[model samples]
Target: MRRSGFLSLVLASALAVPSLACAADHVTGALKGTNGAVHGIVDVTGAPKGVLLRLQVQGLTPGWHGIHFHEKGSCAPPKFTSAGAHVHAATPVVHGLLNADANDAGDLPNLYVAADGTATVELYSTLVSLKGGNNLPALMDADGASVVIHAKPDDYQTQPIGGSGDRVACAVLH
Candidate 1:
């Protein structure tokens, strides 16, 4: 009887481990522009190093669109300046992926939109946290954060958004 009880406990523990690692938090947003509509879902999963960001977006212009996590969560539209600047976890950093000095925490690779105007991409970062602790920038901060899409592609080496034109679409990430 004791041996069978031990085996059962071991099996249960093994089974639960995978589920714990697979646990993820999700947030949804509706991207709206003056003449277009888009929707997005961001899935955050904790990893040993940092976190994984899985994004799915639909209804965007076909091409490369610059995407970043803005400071505020408000998608007020008509320019979306309310979403502040790109997120910086610790000290201020220059805005460029190719920059040797620093890169913004919110900086992500350019989102490639297909001819159908839909995209699904995955990215990882160790700068920010969804768990909201450890002095890290949380997705669910006091004012929240936002995912903004620009009209042009991010050059990854230019200053202040890589000349990505126009705030095309924005979605509040709560």
Candidate 2:
């Protein structure tokens, strides 16, 4: 009986090792925006199945900021406002919203900025990464799409941009 128990323990350990290795392979990088810079990192361990994204913005004014996945990963300014609205993968009709609907694929919840001009955000979406296409645009595509922070909050549902005005900052997810 003791030997059998020992074998089971060994099997459990063996199964756990691979999971830990995969978790370690999670990739990360920096996300640059217009007014300043922010820390953007992604852990794709269970990507397409599970994903973890974290962002921290510094030197930004305190307020509610709109965050979304844009159609291009290029951050070339004039603010890159021409990156063309939030990511919306819905068929037949494309709209943008932070709530569930046929809205923008990039319409995520608001990222609150602290009074000291710092914003920290962490998001886990079932949708795949920029390249996964499980609804998200390819971040590494040729002229890949970008993740943008807007000067206003996504009004949840409005029309043509959800009234999420002013592209404040942008980051190219390469």
Q: What's the distance in Å from true for residue 144, model 1?
A: 0.9
Candidate 2 residue-wise lDDT at 134: 59
Best by TM-score: 1
> Which residues of candidate 2, in runs, are more than 4 Å off?
1-29, 33-46, 90-93, 98-103, 133-138
Clashes of 2: 12
What would the per-residue lDDT of candidate 2 be over residues 1-174, giving only the tens digit for each residue? 999999999999999999887654354445555644553432223365435567767766578877776766567665776676555456534554444555456656777889987766678655435455555544445665666777787776766666767777776654
Per-residue lDDT tens digits of candidate 1, residues 6-91?
Answer: 99999999999978765545555676664645566665665555557777877778999898888898877689999998888766
lDDT of 2 at 131: 54
How displaced is residue 12 in candidate 2, in Å? 16
